[model samples]
Target: MTDLHKHDRVNPLRLPVVAVQGLWLRSTLRLASAPGGGTSGTAPGPTGPPLRLAVLGDSTAAGCGVTGDDEAFAAGFAQEVATRTRRPVDWQVVGQFGATARRVRFRLVPRLDDDLDTVVLLAGANDVLAGRGPSLWREDLTGILADLSHITHQVVVAGIPPFGLFPSIPATLGRYLGERADALNAVSREVCGRNPRTTTFIGSPAGTPPAGFFSTDRFHPSAQGYRFWANDVAARLLPAQPDA
Candidate 1:
């Protein structure tokens, strides 16, 4: 059959399959558009040539507290990557605000591209915030990381940041959250240690957290928070690019 077909109002692949780089991934498909024209599909396009980044995590990565889509970690991260690499960047945000590692393994992990160069993972806080045991949270994060190893050779495990100090939650609960964050970060660091392509970074509140970084909710990081995350992520990314 013809991979190339006229995608009109009736058939959207009307957009020609322009060959980019060595791979022929459908531009329209990448652009989140259907083969048929005159419609909105999830057709995402490449920034420069063909690069894929996957950012998966909880509310922070999903930009729940952030005012606009640009404020989201995924969007901000992509923008930072574009600036750093001086090329257009396309990253697919595959995270639910309260997602756990188990959910990512079964749901988000399956949707990733086989040739993904980098996979940034975040979780654990939600697991603990939900009152789940830290041991189970460790297993979930490790299992998900192991699963990602099959597809992405490079994985960046951002240790769960410290949020307990924030004024948003109760002091008692904040203490509990802080302790769990430490525990889960330990687990994540261990997992990263064992992987050849993995690296871990400690993201705690004590660092240079930008003013207004926290969203209005005072719970999640604001646009500034994501901007900081992007810079931090880029630092980790620089080292991995040579190996990737």
Candidate 2:
């Protein structure tokens, strides 16, 4: 059968599967409760000039699955930065759940202050789900970076996590979404490469995430997962510094 015919023939069967997965996700989320809101703080370190860092993006950047801001990636990364520099880290999060790059550009970007030393952006999952093409993603993401560049000396754009590995999503849909994420990541990398002030951060490797990496909802990262992700980003952002 032609690929088009095959796709049409199999779609009816896939629709029910997709619906079941969607229902399961909704029920699980209701029971798990939403993660606490964004976190901000100054990490402990030897008294010195502090590194002011601002984190921006979607739910992941907001620390969705964690119980509090301390357990979120923003705080975790701040801790890592403090340890490495032996200097205090002043961190703030301006992340919103379910926000696309466009939303972040128009709504969140304006809230950023002018004294930030660095900015970390972890986004693109929502854009993938929203069916935004690579070109559009590149445009929105580059715009966000351009705006951020004016506020901070350094900007780190993180690669989207491997959502296809999420336990809750159906295999077929996960595969499709994975491809979309890959496209966006490529754009992210290119955008970062072209900008001297911006850098790229790669998250966990592809394939299934280890047990306990995700929260009960099987989507957002758990506390442990955020810690792990923060460490990875820290390594790239401060490669010269030793672990603390």
Candidate 3:
């Protein structure tokens, strides 16, 4: 769902601040050739543990056009994480339609606790649709990521897929949305590059346009679209080591 965020600065919906722990954990399953003592430095790493993850964004994160809450992007991502890691995962959801990064900082940032392991950003589309400039969006994003420092074990930004091709929207407007997506994604990528722990943006399936993956409104993603989203994430996470 491409939800919209109000431009009001005076008051926005405030998220409840909850103290959380053990966020964004990576669980890997591997066969041990030999067991080592727990007291030794050579001890094998623990295989399974729950990772605390937070999903924050706009309408797509909110479950719009979805049949139920479970069908949303956040829910599907959680399920996928559990399956791949074989670890219990606790996910916090804070998504509002049409939210810009500014709204997220004001409405959601203050409510976050230090234990959050991962912060998944699915924003920018609405900002574009709302006709906000790229600089404004980038500045807001930088602020959001800055404030989230130390709170996130890993920072991940999802690239805005091409919204211009949606069948339901006006062609010119859709293209504008698509261009904004690409531009914002570039900013997100640059932000991630500056931080070692951050995960670069992963966009949708190759050549798949918004129209083909979205709902009838040509905004939200179809089930098949979510499938592609999950696959891209898994590709990034599946590697046991990145710096290695």
Report lDDT per candidate.
0.59, 0.76, 0.60
lDDT of 3 by residue, 1-244 (tens): 2222223232233201100100100022121111111110111122456677777777665555555445456656766676666666667667776677788878977766677777787787767756576688778988888877758877777877676565555444445456657777887788778875565566655675443466544456666556557566756765433321
Among the numbered candidates, top TM-score falls to 2
Cα deviation at 46, candidate 1, in Å, is: 12
Candidate 3 has what TM-score?
0.72
Residue by residue across 77-175, what tens digits does model 2's lDDT show?
A: 999989888889999988888889999998998988887988999888888776677888988987898788778888888888776788766676566
Candidate 1 lDDT by residue in tens digits, 64-88:
6655556566766666666556556
| Cα TM-score per model | 0.71, 0.85, 0.72
| Ranking according to TM-score, highest score first | 2, 3, 1
Which number leads on lDDT?
2
Worst 10 residues of 2 by lDDT: 1-10
Q: Rank order by lDDT, top first? A: 2, 3, 1
The list of candidate 1 runs beyond 4 A from truth reads 1-48, 199-202, 205-208, 239-244
What is the alpha-carbon RMSD of candidate 1 to the true structure? 18.5
